[model samples]
Target: SMGNQILGGGGFGTRLMSEVREKRGLSYGVYSGFTPMQARGPFMINLQTRAEMSEGTLKLVQDVLADYLKTGPTEKELDDAKRELSGSFPLSTASNADIVGQLGAIGFYNLPLSHLEDFMQQSQNLTVEQVRAALNKHLSTDKMVIVSAGPTVPQKPLPAPTDKPAEQPLGV
Candidate 1:
């Protein structure tokens, strides 16, 4: 989970956002995450871009993932992610409703009473190699299921602008 968060679950700081959205402007938003389930959950990376740019954008994201797998987060990135997560830890149960929700998840998952605190501490203590190893074990760019939705017709280049009016003023 921390690995996914570092990769793309966080907002602008994530690798996906940094590479696909901020750096290249290829996408308005890009994120990746996984949901826990009784069985193995599905991990997903999602983004939206112009149909004309879809292929390139997907290739770029794939390359980013590949590179990340080869070389995991830096020490600074790990520190930043740990801080962000730790800073937000209190808010996870700031309200009664939040507490109930968290408790429900804990119960449903058969987690210990101290699961939340344990998770926070564990996340803070995780090393870069551990995060990379966990991701490398579970994720593969080659096995991804790529899905695209949009105009199927080939896009045409925009017509060049004309200096003259459609009907010139009374034969100029």
Candidate 2:
């Protein structure tokens, strides 16, 4: 599940996190996500690290995205991402404050009132083909905008993971 992969608005993990943090010690935290809106919201990636690592970190992140675009997510990866989204749906809105927050977003977006009720079912139904098709259709690496802010020090390329054994998550 993503609980181990990437840290986004949620800490569900992905390939980006695996490469940027788990493999290389480029940054302390890194995440990327998309918010589909009436038009197109944003495909944003966020990272935090010491000022000196910024240049290398940014370059590495781009490399990650390029690799992903070259080969979209595998079936297992898609399943894991969807599973995390569906399984955590309830816990995500377990609190009253969370409920209100969700409701506010729904209302502001003019989404159906039944959105939450059907979220899990919809998420679980997503197929790898669908995810891949969507990515191929919407994302183009050549056109992506890169924004970097931090130190300008020359940094070395990150080292590859030595023994990326499957990690055992310790807590929720």
Candidate 3:
């Protein structure tokens, strides 16, 4: 999740481009994204790199995350983000299906009807300090789970098997 917060195609893409791809040549592309549900949902970072560079790529991801957390978005960037968010919200309610889905979300999540009503206002009200604080608090490199799927073997051996007996014998 921390990887996602730091590597996804959203605001964090710039860091991935600079640190991992350009500086280290670790990946062809790297991106991070977040989908906040009723509570904090998954933040995901994805990348494409040569199999040999996987470990180094992962390390670079961590380094990039550390840098990003310490230095959040600039004031102009924050203003642009708020503007984009506010501008795009109307499109989220454009179609009947969209409206129904939003309403369903509100009901499912027990959100008040005023939630949608207040969205734009709330987004407008968000301060740069708030965003920076949120980034510092939530996007920590120390609290992360890394999952890699590739041809390269892991540096460490796999964990020992559980002692519980199998339901059916192997090769049955």
Candidate 4:
């Protein structure tokens, strides 16, 4: 989940946002998520771009994902993800509805009474290698399903991912 956050978990600083939208302007938005349920759940990456840019955008997203899987998140990314998750933890119980939802999920999922705090502590203690290994264990670009809904139009190829040394994600 931490790896997902660093890669594409619906934030302005995520890799997908930084690469696919902010850097190259291929799509207005791009995000990925992992939904862990009591049973099977889905991991999804979604984006929307102009019809003509569909194929190119897909390729770009795939390439970015592939590269991310190969290299994993950087130290800075890991720190940022941890910080973000920790900062948001308190909100999970700030409202009655939120607290009820959390409690319900704990009961429904057969989680421990201290599941929330346990999960938060575990998340905070996770090493970068552990996060990367967990992500790699479950995700593969080749196994992903690509679903697009829009007109099919010819378009120029999108630029490939690059090795720019600056802080910002570039190209793809």
**RMSD values, in order shown:** 9.1, 5.3, 12.6, 3.9
- Model 1: pairs clashing at backbone N, Cα or C within 3 Å: none
Assess candidate 3 and give its TM-score to the true structure.
Answer: 0.70
Give the alpha carbon lDDT tens digit for every residue of 139-168 in model 4: 988789878898767787664444442433
Cα miss at 151, model 1 (Å)?
Answer: 2.0
Each prediction's whole-model lDDT (CA): 0.80, 0.65, 0.64, 0.82
Best first by lDDT, ranked: 4, 1, 2, 3
Residues 49-167, candidate 2, lDDT per residue (tens digit)? 65656676677777777766666677777677776676777887999999999999898889899998877777677665565566667667777887777657766544556446244
Better of 1 and 4 by lDDT: 4
Candidate 1 residue lDDT tens string, 24-122: 666667999987886678899998877766676777779889988989888888999999988998999999999999999999888999998798888
The TM-score values for the models, in the order shown, are: 0.86, 0.75, 0.70, 0.88
- Candidate 1 ranges beyond 4 A from true positions: 153-172
Q: Write the per-residue lDDT of candidate 3 for residues 1-172, one digit (tens) a residue.
A: 2223323454433667656555444555677787668777776788876666577667767876776677766666566666666677799899999999999988988988999998778767766566667777666677788998879655432122233323211221
- Which model scores highest in lDDT? 4
Clashes of 1: 0
